[model samples]
Target: MSKKPIKRLAFENLTIEFGDKKIVDNCSFEFPLNRKIRMLFNNDVNKYAVLHAFTQVEGITQGKYFFNEDDVTQFSFEEFMSYRLNMGIGFSTRGLLHNRSLQENLLLPLMYHKMMSMDEALEHLKKFYEYFDISSVKDRRPAEVGPNMQKATLLIRAFIHEPEIVFLDNPEMLLSKGLYANLLQLIDDQVEKGNLKHLFFSTEDEDLSDCIADGFIIVKKNKFEFVENKKQMRLAV
Candidate 1:
């Protein structure tokens, strides 16, 4: 018999409601361990709510989810933390502190897990800083970096943790149209080199369709559709 590949993450029959509005409706998908994916949605999908569903850090009104093949409904906070350790979650607010250095902020998450030594964690941070081309700002405070650099640094923060699946919640939200292409190119290089599988979503991007592994689903009026980037050919950057 052939070996069954690990089911890295999934959302099955997920539906979330706020008052009478169903922000997410009966959504189902899988994140395989070795694949990179981009999820594109416009105004109606409630992007952050979809983001919350993956972590189960936010409560869902009705739905089922799994992380690394185990049901999320059965996990305790400790279990959830353990799950997080196995899968690095590099959220937007993951890095930086008002009074701390970028390097220090990067180490805080690893220290919170209590699994890596200080030296090991520092070395990891250093590598990501170099990989993402953010070493100059790594020593500087986030407030001191330029707007575009800040966004790139956030990506660096994500990459440093070595996440099997990273969620990029519009890290490029503040960048200009030109910078968008550069950031994507840099990230594509990093993903190929670092062996990362990630999910990113954006409302106004023109180039992500070609630069990343794209999978689109639009949820409006409680309906869903799977979109293919190639099918969106006439669209231009």
Candidate 2:
């Protein structure tokens, strides 16, 4: 058997502020690798705020972030890009490029990351297309494809390079339950095969708490807390 990848991530007294208001305040938690985590938020704003902070859309005002035992707390966006390619972020693809073909949208990332050449990217795309049964619309632009296809494209782009950690933002809102289940299965397979070490999915649905494999994180009264039950989370919310 192959040894599993070690891609540990931790937040030590992490805080993010928007002017006078603090979005994430003094949050401290370490996400366990080789497990699935559900990130529950009190509201949509909080959901987006946490995701943005992780993706560096906003700045961290305090504390340290450790990845693979290294303090990357002060790393800039450019620094993150040259780092281990440890993280991947996914959002709804409804607003994908209208001018570029779907294939181009997916191929560009592979090429930019130096993961594959044009011919290699095309071959990789073909495999994913066949796996998702999206080959028919592979050449079409985003606007021409249906919602399901768009969601598939987005997911493929997110996981094509097989990053150690993946951050999914409101995927349930973008894909149907069937698609969501498939996505979950994909993550599970990756985890089992040691291809993915951690998966963090953020959402506002209280019911999603049941899907937590290793507990869930929630924003309670503007503070991030990890919990096991939705009822207790409701009290904090």
Candidate 3:
């Protein structure tokens, strides 16, 4: 028997389109494992489309998405579900269920995946709520909480299960200075503990990106360009 090659999280000859427009044209890049990557885009629409495609929240026009040697684009329902179990994604907006309480929203993934019991999930979430200072709004529905609280919940939910790869779309939006600092700290802690092996985030804040990202992925002219050095990333920007 031959051992399968490890591709990790990667996109090969990927193309994404919106209607008649090609957002990403035959882009191929393997996301480096155990590193924080900042995704840069020329425009919001392109950013949205590419990010959605990366997370499989939207369909790709063409190409393959590989995760640990498996083609995610070819995954069946069961396969996709299994693939998603190793991923944690935080959307910029409308990520939570409107009818569900904040606590419920954060707890669903952990419980549904059967990663832990209800008690264990809640107990696990307690620290996050405290750290993000959203404990008071836990029982409130998404509509009832402020944007910061809602965003905090979504961010917490992403890492709640300690998935191998985390995709955060515009993670800094609607967060306070203190809360944002706390978020960075949380990420540092997670990485240090070896719980989060890969993190890809799109943020409009260049300073934040420069401060945290180990590398840069620039999405422009329907292509994905990788920059491993901070100086090169700045020049690319």
Residue-level lDDT of model 2, residues 1-237, one tens digit each, is 122244667778888766566777787877665656777666533556667777663667888877767667676666556444656677844546679888888887688777778888888778666546778888899889878788887777777777777787766665666665566666676677666777787665544435644656666434666665556656655
Which residue pairs of candidate 2 clash? Answer: none
For 77-160, candidate 1 gives per-residue lDDT tens digits of 675765565444445444457577677667777787664899888776776665446677777777877766666666666655
Whole-model lDDT, model 2 = 0.68
Q: Which candidate wins on TM-score? A: 3
Compared with the true structure, what per-residue lDDT tens digits does model 3 show for residues 58-134? 55768888877778787776757766776789988778999999999988878776888988888999988877988
For each candidate, give its TM-score against the true structure: 0.75, 0.82, 0.91
Q: Against the true structure, what is every candidate's RMSD?
A: 4.8, 3.8, 3.3
Q: Give the clashing residue pairs of candidate 3, or none.
A: none
Overall local distance difference test of candidate 3:
0.80
| Off by more than 4 A, model 3 | 1-7
Ranking by TM-score: 3, 2, 1
| Candidate closer to the true structure by lDDT (higher is better), 1 or 2 | 2
Using alpha carbons, what is the TM-score of model 1? 0.75
